[model samples]
Target chain A: MNKLMVYMFKNFIRMLLLLLFVSITAFILVSLSPIDPLQANISQTALGSLSQEQIDKLEMYWGVNEAPIERYLAWVRAFLHGDMGTSLLYRQSVASVIMQKLSNSLMLMVFAWIISGGIGFFLGILSGMNRGKIIDKLIKGYALLTASAPTFWLALLFLLVFSVWLGLFPIGLSVPIGMDAASVSLSDRLQHAILPAVTLSITGISNIVLHTREKMIDVLESEYVLFAVARGEKRWEIFRHHGLRNILLPAITLQFASISEIFGGSILVEQVFSYPGLGQAVVTAGLGGDIPLLLGITVISAAIVFAGNFIADILYGIVDPRIRKGARS
Target chain B: MDRIPILDIQNLSVSFSQYVDMFRKNDLQVIKDLNLKLFEGEVVAVVGASGSGKSLLAHAILGILPYNASFSGRMSYCGEPLTQMRIEQLRGKEIVLVPQSVSYLDPLMKVGFQIRKSVNDKRSKEKMLQTLNRYGLGEEVEKLYPFELSGGMARRVLISTAVMDSPRLVIADEPTPGIHIDAAKQVLGHFRKIADDGAAVLIITHDLELAIEAADRVVVFYAGMTLEEAQASDFSDESKLSHPYTRALWRAMPQNGFRAIESIKEADL
Candidate 1:
């Protein structure tokens, strides 16, 4: 118990440091870019009659007159206090804009993640157990095709088939544009999400299936598993007790490591389907030079990545006694 | 007095089907024309050099051979024909194996949990603890993982796991390599004790000296065939050993002047 506490504490500290480093890097990169948020907004919004005093006032209001490092420190301080600053693009608090879109993306990701993980894990075990058989070969081919296919193209194909031709699912968005999301039924939300969620999950499922299949094959061939069989352990008992536990740790680590790529793919899928998710929000923020909004999104994404790896580490300590012993020592 | 053998294997042959080309296939025979029997209250050490099919013989009896390997043999356990289903039923209770590699221990499991396996009853737990104690392992060692154990400790744990159930037949495959000499003898001594308690123990090893010291009878194997089966006392003199290969092996022992013999081809043997 003491060792577990210490392990969690250490992981927490590492996550905090990683977030700090990522925030600093994101802030510095955005600050050094050619685009200036205040100037960009002013030139786009103002007519030719704008005065120099007005320009200076806008710069002062946005804290652009301060040094870059000072501005970053101020942003960090506000972020630590749960204030993500104001967005020049949306004319609202960055937190509010992000919070509004975060739910949509979270819904899509939750569906895709659960569906892909379940299908991938089940098929991986089947293919691994019956390696070189017909089912294994079929899954391998499917994995190859899906892993290489472009996400946007797949989304367009789904939209063409399911929305335009069959009319089975809505083409885009988490909820209908004019309807209040709170009043929407759960089934309606699901109907709208099916096309985009399936598109986003195809690649994730293929990648996980391939990774898990390979790992399970290695685990099955391990000497201990063979010994378990020789000890008269039932086939299911060996898989349940020995095989699955060994396979799950690496599979989870791979899942967490692929989060960024999954997020990147989600953006392309969202844009193709016109989904009202954080992916679309990030696209608009980038094109509009919404620095505060962009930085806020980057920080949240970094936090998710850090949390994923942190969870994997804790789970490693829990599932594998060798690691737990090492941590305790 | 004719005592009933606990395990009997007759005319055992093992071969694997390998694809030689895109279309052609060949059968590679690994073990052929093998026969052996083990009676209760005796330790039979099968001694051979590496690649002599000793371990395969052990795997064959345990019914854990690789998928491609095909076996044609007659085997019986206590006068009943031993089928695959019967072996599964008897394994780990009536019969058990001490595998060759210490890697056989699961890295994810604690030593105690692995030895107890599926049985969590009070009697099984007490028996496990007693077995571990007999092997000189402390209580704390039960909580340690396989990687945490020293080579000797892992060997002892493997022995404890095999012998805990008081099996009728025990097949140990090269269980003493990579441990201290004294520790090796101690492990063999434990197997001897098990045999003395009436279980038929088969210890497969390449160490002729150790076999001669611990076994009541020694079976010498060459090129997947048994060359000679003799009392361990016969190994005291090279002339008393029957086969030429067995005599060569005795000469090759360090205590026997380590004489180098010309390579004998399988066809000649």
Candidate 2:
């Protein structure tokens, strides 16, 4: 128990450091960007109509006139006290905006994660067990092609085929544009999410498929597997007993580690789909120079990715007793 | 004492087809005309140098040769011809293998579950516990994974896994490697005990001293061929050995002055 506590404490420290690094990096890059917040958000006509004194007041209010260091310190101070400031673009609290956007993105990303893992694991097992066969070759070819293809390109292709050509699904957005929030059903949201979710899942699936296939091949060829066969175990019986558990750990590790990729890909996927998710919000904040919103998203996304890896570490112990014993020691 | 042998193998030859060029393939013979008989209540040791194709014999009996390997042989179990289908049926139930490395045990699985295999009946569970107890292993050892075991304990666990089904024939492939002398002796003794209980035991190894100590008969393999097969007692006198290579091996024993003729290759002798 004491060891577990220490391990958790260490992880907590590492998470804090990662959040700090990500926030600082995002802040620096945003600061260096040539896009001026005032110029990007306010029209030229509005700037021309304002008097010099009024423009000074507006600049002060926006914290544009403040030094970069003082601005960063103030933002950090406010953040420590649960004040994520307000979004320059949305005129709302950064936290609430993120919360709303995150819920939508979470639904989309979770669906993609689950679907990719399930399909990838199944395909990997098939390819690995029947290596050099026609099915293996086809799966390998598909995985390779999909892994190298760009996420935005795939999203456009899905949108064109499913929405434009076939007229089967919506072209874009989380829901129908004029639909009332109260009137929308689960089916409506799912119908809208299916395209983007599938597009995002396509890229995620290839990596898992390739990694898991390699791991499955290795497990099948291990000495223990040979012994299992020598023990009179049938092919499927050996797979059930010796192959599954050994391969499961590596698959899980790859699954969780791919969260960063999933998150990264959603940025492009959300843009192509025009979905009102955190990924789309990130682009909005980045373009409009909403530092508070961007920094908040940065920290949260880092935490989420780190949390995924942490869960994988914990699961390693549960899935394999050897790792658990090693941790105890 | 003229009863039919429990396991009979004759004129067994194994070869592998290897690609020397893109189109040309060569057949590399690994085992040639290897013949042996193992009766119930006796242990036969196929003694040879390490990597001398002794393991191929065990693999041959289990019907697990690789894809490119081919064999021509007659193998019978209990007076019946052992075909591929027959070996498949008998393996893990009537016949079992105690493999060479500790790695042969699945690292993720508990020892008890591995021993019991697919049988989950209360009677099989009792039998598993009895087998472990017979090997002087505590019940707690069953819950431990293979990595948690000491060398000797793991060796005993491997033996227990093989004998749990009360198999008619047990083939142990180089079971004593990487273990201390005393532990090695203990493992050999376990095989001897298994044979004494009316199962035929085939132990493939390179340790002539250990073989002569534990086996009823010893077969010497040189260049993948059976050069000599003699009673264990015949090793006591060099003149009693039929083959010149067998006499060279007897003289090479440490107790026999560790002598070797220049004509015999160091690897083979």
Candidate 3:
């Protein structure tokens, strides 16, 4: 229990550090970028032809005149209390906008991760067990191809193949055949999300397959397997028990990072398919220079990434003794 | 006694080959017709210069030989064909190896974990500690890693792991090398108790005096073949030896208890 307490305290410190690093870096980076947030906003709004006085008033109103540190601190302070201010273009509270689209992104990402992780784990185990066999060769070839291919390009190509050429599904929208959002079934929602999810899953599956395979190879060569085999343990039991436990540890940790990526990285798929998601909100806000919304999404994305990695470390500590020993909370 | 040895070998040849050319491979023959045997419950020691296949015979019997080594002819364990048995099954539960150095174990594993690993039961943790205590290794040795253990303690722990599983045959390779004689004797004494428990122990070493004092029977090896086989009592009467190599090795041990021989001398003795 004392050890658990120490671990928790250390984890809290790490969480704070991750938040600090992400927010500060994001703040500094956006502040330094050449794009004029005011101009970027004016061009997209009725305020484009306004006087310099109105622009000054707008800058003062938005607290853009404040120091970057002060602005960042104020933003963080507001975010902690669930107040992310309002977008200049959309004129909606950042939180409300995020909540509106969070579900779509979640639906796409969760299913993507499940599909990728499940398939990757099975294929990895298969390949590792049959190292030089035909299945191993096929898995290796597939993993290599998917990992090297750009995800955004894959999303575009998939849109062409599945939505355009086949006419099997709608191309750029989450609804089927102009159906009202209020009447859409859960099955329809999942069907609409499938292409995007597949788009998101390709590289993720590749990463998991590659990592699990490498770890399995290492585990299979370990002395414990030899010892286990000496005990009359069947070959499949070695794969299922000792081999799986050791290799899955690293894969489990990777699972969290993949989760964060799916959530934060579904932007292109959402855009190409016109799926209303937090990713779409962020992309629109970023390009249109909606300061509050962009800053809010950036901060949230960073937080989610930080949270995913933190959870991974803790979960990994539980699974792997090597980590559990040295990796304190 | 039955005429058939507990472990018998006839023309047991082994080799390793590597691809040296596009259409050809080079073969390295490590052991040639290495005929030898050990009896049940006997503490038999094999001693020679390094690379004389003292370790290879143990590997061949246990079927833990490197992938390259192609072995031929019969090598049996209690009249059972060794080559045919699953290599992994023969280890720990059947034939355990007390390796030359204790560092051979996975360094990441705890001493107790390695001990438990040999027995294949997670409850082997508590059981191993109790078994270690029976062999005179106390409780503190359990939590420590292999690096933290004293040379003597490490050796004893290796033996503790070996016998924890109660194997029928324990092939120990130089169980007491590079340690002081006092520690060596202490370890050898432990080996004797293990042999007394009705297990066949094949010890490979060059320490003639240690072998004479500890082993019930000694099989001497030179250049990958058995040179001589004799009972421990037969050593008192030196004329009973058959092989020139065995006679030379026996003559090489210094008469003084602690003092080792200065050098081995012979013009083909």
DockQ for every prediction shown: 0.63, 0.73, 0.27
lDDT of 3 by residue, B157-219 (tens): 888778777777787878888899988988888878887887778898877778888888877
Instruction: Return the TM-score for each candidate structure.
Output: 0.84, 0.93, 0.78
For candidate 1, the per-residue lDDT at A139 reads 95
Name model 3 segments beyond 4 Å from true.
A38-82, A176-179, A319-329, B11-14, B18-33, B48-56, B78-81, B85-168, B173-187, B205-212, B217-269
lDDT-better candidate, 2 vs 3:
2
**Chain B TM-score (each prediction, in order):** 0.96, 0.95, 0.86
**What docking grade does candidate 1 earn?**
medium
Off by over 4 Å in 1: A1-86, A132-142, A180-190, B1-4, B19-26, B138-141, B258-268
Write the residue-wise lDDT of candidate 2 on B1-269 in tens digits: 67999899999999999999999999999999988899999999999888789988899999998779999989999999999999999999889999987799889988888988856799988998999999999999979999999888888888988988788899999989877888888889999899888899999999999999999999999888898999999999988998878888888889997987447765553
Instruction: Please provide, for model 1 over B138-210, each residue's C-alpha lDDT reduced to its tens digit, 9 standing for 90 to 100.
Output: 9888788888988888888998889877799999999789677888899899999999998999999998889
What C-alpha lDDT, on a 0 to 100 scale, does residue B91 get in candidate 3? Answer: 68
* Least accurate 10 contiguous residues by lDDT in model 2 chain B: B260-269
lDDT of each: 0.85, 0.90, 0.75
Candidate no. 3 TM-score: 0.78
- Per residue, candidate 3 scores C-alpha lDDT tens digits across A126-211 of 88888878999999999999889877788889989998999777686666777887999988877888888888888678888888
- In model 1, how large is the Cα lDDT of residue A292? 80
